[model samples]
Target: MTMIVRDFRPADAEAVAAARRSAFPYLVTTAETVTWEVAGAPAERQYRLLVAEVDGQVVGSSEIGVFHESEEPGLAFANTSVRTDTLGRGVGSALVTAAEEWLAGLGAAKIFAWTVEAPHAVTFAERRGYRRGRSSRVQRLDLTTAALPPLDPHGLPDGVELRTAADFLNDPRPLYEADVECTEDEPDDVPAGRLPYDQWITLTWEHPSLDRELTTVAVVDGTVAAYSVAHTDGRGSYWSGMTGTLRAFRGRGLAKLAKNDALHRARAAGCREAFTGNDGDNQPMLAINKWFGYEPAVTEWRYVRELAA
Candidate 1:
């Protein structure tokens, strides 16, 4: 049967989400979040979502776009995923070809993609001229089975307080500021460029997957010092979107405090599974996850190819 690759339609949201979930089960994904991404993507991103159909059945999907926020010009990405059952049917190649053509048309000089560390997936990327780059590990915790570290509020600094993201619904600028500062220091192959407050509010703060009530924040002397952003699928699965402490608060264990509080709250809320990812070389963050009893689940490698200008 012939495979057809075309732009994703609104009606394909559910199929696309399902394909992504099958390919990357460690990450949180839903139809609502997929729709929001396509509809609200920044203009500069030039985002395009495409799907590969076989005999009228959607079996693969890809999200391709320039990294608009990157300080470096011409950096782009095309992440593709094929349903596990549909592998070896050419869907993966077709999706990647379509995405590469779309991104190259946008004057992209380099295109990056991620693939699970499985041999077949890595071989597929290698055969496409993509070179391996940095890697990250996905960790999972059985919230229902594992004993979470005890939270000792008394151990917090004298002027420190723990709060939820929902508490700042009326005023999230402080959280935004804290996010910007911590993001700047995150380990990444590509620079983590500055994100404006307005965009943060729209993309991160208002995202459908975010669970404001379960996200914990650490405040020191009335200043936002650290936070753990939580995302839940409302189906017993939870993800730590991000956990970081402001530069001034680093080494004080505030990040641990915030994440511990958030995780405790998540388990209490009946979330059975928890997931998070960290750069392979991010020792501090990896140590923190280890302390929380999260077990390594999967590893993914970033691959990049130069696009002829």
Candidate 2:
């Protein structure tokens, strides 16, 4: 059983997405998102999608790219996903090896990855010279059964208005500005700086999975004070990609309001399951998710390895 690792072709999107879902069922993945990631990544990121094939069938895949948006240089990441049924077939190792060689050739100083907190997964990463770091919680909410908060649009705070991402199609600069402010406050190992408007539009706002109708925003005096970005697979699965509020809007419960509205909209739109990730240290957001009846599905730890010069 020879395993061959090679660059990903557009035709491999479905297999790659299936492998990813098999490895981490809690996360939402679709072939369309996989194709968009590979085709729409910024050039400076040096993004490469690697696939592992056994007898012409894809069994694993890895998303490898530089942290081009981070102010810090030489930081890269390579996340490998192998089908659960093929766990011990060395497919993961082969994908990681190929990703490292390519990233090292590009002068990457450090590589980061996320692995499930299970014992076998932890050991696999450790044996590959990766060290454990921060962890995040993957949570799931059953949209069909959860008791979602009532959406009373007219009950918002004084002068605060509720809007959907679709309302900003004419001018999304406000949303981009809000995203920049909110992203800066997110807890992460890498410090990501502001992305150019054009890049944000290409990579985020215009993404195929982004459900503008379900993305709720809180506006205060005509300003985007908070928002919850929604992503859906068109298969009854929804993901809360990001939820944040501007600094000035803190303590107003705007983030909670926005996310609540988004979740409700998702349920009404035929989505059955919802998912979101929260950093272990982010108590506020974690509490918000808990309020929505989301249960802990899994924990994934960030792993890092210094590349040998």
- Best lDDT goes to which candidate? 2
Summing lDDT over every window of 10 consecutive residues in candidate 1, give the lowest-scoring window: 148-157
In candidate 2, what are the lDDT values of residues 88-157, reduced to their tens digit? 9889989999999999999999999999999889999999899988899999999999999888856888
> What lDDT score is found at residue 269 in candidate 2?
98
Model 2 is weakest, by summed lDDT over 10 consecutive residues, at 149-158
Question: For residues 70-163, what per-residue lDDT tens digits would candidate 1 score against the true structure?
Answer: 9999999999999999998889998999899888888999999989999889999999999999999999999999888798845777899999
The CA lDDT of each predicted structure is 0.91, 0.93
Backbone clashes for every candidate come to 0, 0
Cα TM-score per model = 0.97, 0.97
